[model samples]
Target: MKALKKIATSLIILALAAVPAFAGQQGESSGILTWLFLGFIGLIVVGQLIPALVMGFGMVKGVLGHSDDHSHKHNA
Candidate 1:
């Protein structure tokens, strides 16, 4: 009985691990969740990636220096 229980447990683990190996073998589309996840990742890439790249380039170019753009006014 103990050996049978150990074999059953090992079979269950093996089956769980093998699940992804046979994934998409059936002719079925990946459905809406995949597209929705991709869309979410796309939005994040657009919102964060572009600005980060631009800011990095600007930093390398020294475009963030605080220059005196306003004239100083003297008051008594």
Candidate 2:
């Protein structure tokens, strides 16, 4: 029973060791996925930042009364 346990443990260790080797074989799909993940993150970051920047600029412009043209345009 002890010998059987030792063999089983050794097999388990070998299997675990092979996990990295299997991961290494995941190739181009993994690289593509990583780049896609980064791009998604960048898009989200930019999406959040751009709106905030625009809102800030709009607030500053509004407070400064920079867009007070309330006159209706005459249609030709």
Candidate 3:
């Protein structure tokens, strides 16, 4: 009947769609040296970031203090 035709067509489509999944090959992993190099790079980045943040915060504090120093107009 008409319903049977539609069911057969859907099953054919589903089977074709699943072919790629069955064809996939497993990948090999990079080993420990890759991890060690990545860790070393991460450390270098973090080390640079800490001093940059401290200097940024110090600049912000200095700017805010300059604004507060406005009350010392009489000192001029």
Candidate 4:
């Protein structure tokens, strides 16, 4: 099952990467709408990256066994 998942993921990534190559040549100037569409896509990408970065930091912190000072304080 894991192997199948990896193969499927690889194929999907390859398909996405090939898109730009299949695109028509941009010979004319792009208007505001084109810029807005690109900007929206950029924002979506950054939104995804933020969560991924947070998860990655958490994984690293877990592996290092780091804890906050508050967790160590106890009340009698």
Highest TM-score, which number? Answer: 3
Query: 1 or 2: which has the higher TM-score?
Result: 2
Model 1: per-residue Cα lDDT over 23-74, one tens digit each: 8587868889999999999998899978997888789667767776678787
List where candidate 2 sits over 4 angstroms from the true fold: 1-30, 66-76
For model 3, give the 10-residue run with minimal summed lDDT. 66-75
Model 3 Cα RMSD, 1 decimal: 19.1
Cα lDDT of model 3 by residue, 28-64, tens digit: 7769999999999999999999999799879988877
If the candidates were sorted by their TM-score against the true structure, best first, what order would they fall in? 3, 4, 2, 1
TM-score between model 1 and native: 0.42
TM-score of each: 0.42, 0.43, 0.52, 0.50
Using lDDT as the measure, what is the rank order of every candidate, best first? 4, 3, 1, 2
Off by over 4 Å in 4: 1-26, 66-76
Q: Write the per-residue lDDT of candidate 2 for residues 1-76, one digit (tens) a residue.
A: 5986899899999999988887666445557888999999999999999899789878977898866677989889
Best by lDDT: 4
lDDT of each: 0.86, 0.85, 0.86, 0.89
In model 2, the number of clashes is: 0
User: Across residues 3-73, which tens digit of lDDT does each residue of candidate 4 receive?
Assistant: 86899899999999999995877677889999999999999999999999799878987989966667575
Q: Identify the runs in model 1 with alpha carbons over 4 angstroms from their true place.
A: 1-27, 63-76
